[model samples]
Target chain A: MHVDINSYFATLLQQENPALRGRPVGILKDVGRTCVIAASKEAKKLGVGTGTSAYEAKRLAPEIVFLPAEFARYLDATKRLKKIFSNLVPDYEIFSLDEAFLNLTDCTRLYPDAQEFGRHVQQLIKDDLGEFVTSNVGISWNRFLAKMAGEIAPKGSVAEITAENIDHYFATTEFKDVCGIGRRLEKRLAHLGVTRLYDLHFVTDEQLETEFGPYWSKELRKMSEGKEPSLFAHHAKNEQPKSVSRSITGFSLAKDEAEIRAVMRNLIDEVMYKAREMQLSGRWAAVSLSGEGQHWWSHQRVDMPIRHAQELFDILYHQLYSQWDRTFNVIRWRVVLSDLGSWETTPEPWLPDWQRQEKLEQAAQELNKRFGLFTVRSGVLLQRPLIRPEVTGYLGDRQYVLGP
Target chain B: MYQTIHESIEVAGVFTPGKFSPTKFRWGKKTFAVEAITLLSRERDGLVPIHHYSVVASGTVFRLSFHPDNLAWFLEEVWQEGA
Candidate 1:
């Protein structure tokens, strides 16, 4: 079963403001400086959607209400909805902030009928999350079909896909309806004479492999049959991510090397904070800068697993400074720590000062945890306005922090 | 239009069995009865817990923030209808 909220952030805004109900509304990361992160149904009718610039959105919908995103409030709503799902099924995978999939193979027998069960789940969400908050529920044998069903389902409704109806659904659906086939892939498939989901059935495996890689070709074949790829069988389990990154956007390009270094320091602080929270260490550190019509990325594989933010910063500083050109203004900066492993599996440094440095880092972590983030941050971060961190969604490399 | 104003205010609410819900508040010389609590959220300011409330009163919505550290209430924002 797949449950998805409708216009998640924008709907939440309307749910909070009665004046916003039935009106075009869009949620922005900030009022003056960011793009539209989410748009309400009314706004969508005006051709305003996520990724639309605030200025463009206003031009499209003159009366569109733009509200800053309240992530803490949205997260609170997600938590409440999660509790409702917990009551329905014991096993579920949270695909994103507004979407989740439940494994009902073992629990479907508890209900008299699957459609009734879906309705019950929808009603429970509405009852618990106010009448304005609504969801689409989709029920099928696997996650992919269920998600597709939910996407095609009407707002505040449920759609169930079974073997009897799967072929009919695919015959009418477009290639983009499938989860993995995005706009780029859809265009690629179009060039291959596979414009619809039904068209995928006619393409040979070798042809698909030649166009897309071997992995995606097999996945597309399975999706064409209304069957999920075998790799998604363990969807419910939480697997450790291979990399964690933090990035900042919307800011102008840094004017000098010092400004860039300060931004890098702050970015590393955010990544390391999450790494320590997860108790993971990485062997590769990467730094990327984008702006002024140029994009540069540099990375270094360290001799030892880097656990502290300072160590990661040291590697990135050397790699970035050596190649950085002051002529180009850097509008965005990103720091990534990849090749991760459990901290317990990491070997300790043999230097005499290693223990002392580790103790200092631990103490700093404790202080920041006791206080708020960056309460004990480096001096380099203090030269500018504090870079507030946010969790955009599950897809980005940004840190995901739950609760208050 | 939304205007930002962080000013101290007084709120009247009920403390019922582990929860607090504001019913009215006074800012300057005017008192607005909270018709509905549109949204309520809690977030941390450093180590201190801050409660934020979005309330609609007299056909307008106001964002109220409460700081537990000093037990102070702040009128954070005002959204006048049709503004």
Candidate 2:
């Protein structure tokens, strides 16, 4: 069964802050637009959850504690927890930072039942890690149903979502609550009057085929029937970020528009220069600005194709200042390059030619090699830097995120 | 502990310029700066941070170990590198 730890990050914050005990809390990431990634169990009891925006969470629970994410710390903690899991369950798959699954179907004799096995895991995590990690273990025939069971169960509780309760789980849940289901699919599924899992389960194969196409119709039916593809499995070192991003906080709310633009520019130049030096590019660039009283603004690259680092930076640099101007003091700024596209120097049809593109790439390389990545930068990026000699890049020639 | 890591960093350039790595941590989160950002459009292999005359004297290390928390974080990474 899947063991789901609700609001693991929020729980960590609450546990660390004695003052935040029993209070609603939200986790903040550099992606300021992503209101809330996780909320504390207390917040959930108040009907706040994963999709709850930070603004909404703040409105609901005015006393909510906002915690910035420190991914490195969480990674360290997860490793410690995983070590305990390896010792206890010979076969366990870490699903995410806060969840995992133990194949207890074979080890039924190890505990009285799945619930006891789950209890043992919960206690083990809390005791070993010295953190209160309440896990909801779902016992089912397979990994998919088991994970669903864990998710639907009450906090610090366990329930088996078998043929019996599977109906209840789907009936009471939204499309997104179903793992592997996304919004577009849900809306598409709705077109066939299959708005609920029961609707999908009861739909004839032909009707499903008519709606989702031949291949996916049966797949949707299988999912509705409480079956899933597979459990989270360990892979080689391939699970990593396609690109890296860096952002910072701390600017006056009174900074002028030009001053704000300069800061954004410095940040852009640093990231672009480093990305260029590293020979990496992404399909989407995430730019975010956070200000006083929990105000956060984010703009994804809408104009550029986001195929390369320079392109991503160019989009972010132009858009942020043009939009925010000097209206708000930049409490923080972040840049994330994601959706790593193909890494090749194919000739652009618009500006096609090996020589021209190579010439541009070569110029950037030479400037970086001579003066370090920061030595010579685009004038667009050198506008700001009220803060002298700012921090830049994971190291000399790279941005971070794909995990060094 | 401070002196140990300080030693692994190699100084380069004519005028006590920047530093280069004399040792590299070879595992898990201890990333090679080269492999850190797989999508940043870097044209080179890795980075050599320019410490700058101002930052060095500005006490980068002093600021790092300024508090017990920072010291603990630094020492742990340093220790983890070897272990």
Candidate 3:
């Protein structure tokens, strides 16, 4: 069973503004100044989403009001909400911070119906916490259709997807719309001239094994007709990244070597900062610069992992700059920390008193975490600076990686 | 009610953002003109400090801090002094 906190973000916005109750609200999104992420159901009905231009949203929904996405705050609320959810429901998996899945098989006897279970969850979250809780239950014979059933179910509703009705449902269901039938599968199915569930359902076991990987293909056949294993608690402990990458596509494209070096220097600085955040070090790097003449040049390096953020930047920039005489005059350039050079084993190396600089950056990250970015930066970063550029799209944000 | 904190920290500015190594903030030799503001963001369930930076016409950089402790006061001050 899955639960959705309906309009999770919009509800947060309304919670902040009492007068905005039941009114149209949308989060004015920014990827270094780009688009909105989620909008209220009202605004959504008016065609608002991640890519909806501000002017367009304004035109479509005149009553729509804007709220900036406070990721840190929302993260806080979700943690509280998740804890409450975990306590209330046994064996729950967080689907998204805003959603959860609970295996109701064990509790079916205790709770008479899925409806009652859903309502209890809904009320528990809304009453105890300050956010809205809206959920739908899909009692399916299996997982694939259950997920689909959950998505299409009306608000505050439930649907049964047992063997009896699974066929009827898939007969009209679009293959592309199915959650697991990703684009590659769709293409393969198209090549085989099989585009619908019906087309795949009757295939023989021999053909299935030969065509797709025996394990996954076999699993697919079972899931398609509404029979599959329940998903287990699959949360993997979050691992500190081996490498952190930050890229920028300059809004004002660089025309020459100097600008490219300036940007490359900044990119190295960003990647190094993230490495330090995770207390990881990188032994290898893949740095690339792209430019106007359809020109692109990239360099890869292997060295001992460096944790001192400033020194990492200094080494990378010095190398990247040497390579950029011709290739860095482009629209986009990036630096990536690859092959995590080392783990958190040691602290900054000591140098002459005057040469000591690494500890200062470590202090800067903590200070900024207390404050914000650029509160303190390497003096070199301050030399001939470049402003962050904006990204314009529904899916990709140029400015997303260039952040704290 | 909203007021603007005029301090403009260089974001995605001449320097790349988040590309710095030693990802934490430093006091360095000089303290900022305005201390970073600190707040316990509900989202993070921890303290989040924001350093507000602004630049003058002459390209000199000035910095300020924003935190939970000073959020209300900062908002009020911005409102009063805002253009």
Candidate 4:
């Protein structure tokens, strides 16, 4: 079963403010950002949606009200929603902030009828969350079909796809409706004169391999038959991250070395803080900069675990920034730490100087934790507007916050 | 339209074991009676948790936040008919 909140962020705002209810609304990532991250159902009907520019959205629906995203509200609601869902369905996977998948194999006795179960869950959400916030539930034998069913289901309704009705849905649905088939894949499939899932019957296996390569060819065949080979693989919870990265676009382009260095220091601070929070260390570090229609990126493998911001910054500084031509103003900066391994499992330090630095890092982390992040930041970040930590719309690091 | 007014304010409210609801608050020279608390959410700054209350009052929506560490109330924002 796949349950997805309808217009999650925008609907939550509507639920919060009575005046916003029944009106078109667009959600922005921040006050200054122009991209509409999410749109209320009313706004979507008028052609305003995610990725729609604020200017375009205003033109599409002049009466639309815009609100900056309140991630705290959404995350709080998700925590409560998860509590309600876990109580009823133990075997569940959080697909995103507003979506979840439940494996009802063990709960069949408790929920004999999946459709009834879906409705019961919806009622619980309405009762615990507000009346304006609604979810669409879809049930099927696999996650892929269940997600598709949920997409087709009406807002605040339940849908189920069985083996008998699978073919009917495949014939009626377009290739784009499938979860894994993106626009690029759709165009590729269309080039071969395949418009629907049912059209895969006409194309030979060799042809699919030639177009989609070997791995996706097998996946596509399974998708055409409404089967998901790795349906259970996504259920793995509390999995440590393989890599950690943080990137930010400057409010205005940085024209000099001082500005670029400050931004890099801030980004590295964030990356290292996250790594420390996860109790992980990286063997690889990368830095990338973008501006003036040109991009520069470099990465290197370090001899020791990249545990500190200063350490990673030193490597990136020598490789990328020191060699920079300074021809164009940089508009964005990104720092990445990959090849992660458990810091807790690593052997104890043997060098006195290294041990002293480690203790200093620990003390600094402790102070920052109590006073707030960046309270003990490097002097380079002083007097600068602290970027602080932020939650991504994708909720990619959900496992670090919520356990299985 | 909406306006951001992150100013400290005086508020009358009900405070129970686990509930904190503001009934009325004074901003500038006017006191607005909260008709309804439409939503409540909590966010963290460093280690301090700030609780926000979205309320309807005087034909407008107001976002009020409470700082537990300082036991202070702030009028964060207000939304009216137009800019």
DockQ, every prediction: 0.53, 0.03, 0.13, 0.62
- Which should have the higher DockQ, number 1 or number 4? 4
**DockQ category of candidate 3:** incorrect
Model 4 / residue A207 / CA error / Å: 2.1
Error of 4 at A132 (Å): 1.2
Which 10 consecutive residues of model 4 chain A have the lowest summed lDDT?
A229-238
The parts of candidate 2 lying over 4 Å away from their true place are A29-37, A50-55, A70-72, A105-112, A163-176, A214-218, A229-404, B1-83
Model 3 agreement with the true structure over A61-136: per-residue lDDT tens digits = 8877776665544555565556766676575555554655666766777776776666677677665444344556
TM-score of chain B of each: 0.92, 0.15, 0.22, 0.91
**C-alpha lDDT score of every prediction, in listed order:** 0.82, 0.56, 0.55, 0.85
Interface C-alpha root-mean-square deviation, candidates in order: 2.1, 13.9, 12.1, 1.7
Residues A129-241 of candidate 2 have per-residue lDDT tens digits of 44555668788887777877777777888788767667777877777667767789898988777777877766788887887896677678778877674323222123434
Query: Model 3 compared with the native: what TM-score?
Result: 0.63
Q: Residue A20 deviation, candidate 2, in Å?
A: 2.4
lDDT of 1 at A285: 87
How far residue A235's Cα lies from its native spot in candidate 3, in Å, is 5.8
Highest lDDT scorer: 4
Alpha-carbon deviation at A91 in model 2, angstroms: 4.0
| Over 4 Å off, model 1 | A230-236, A395-404, B45-48, B81-83
Comparing 2 and 3 by DockQ, which wins? 3
Give each model a TM-score.
Answer: 0.93, 0.53, 0.63, 0.94
lDDT of 1 at A335: 90
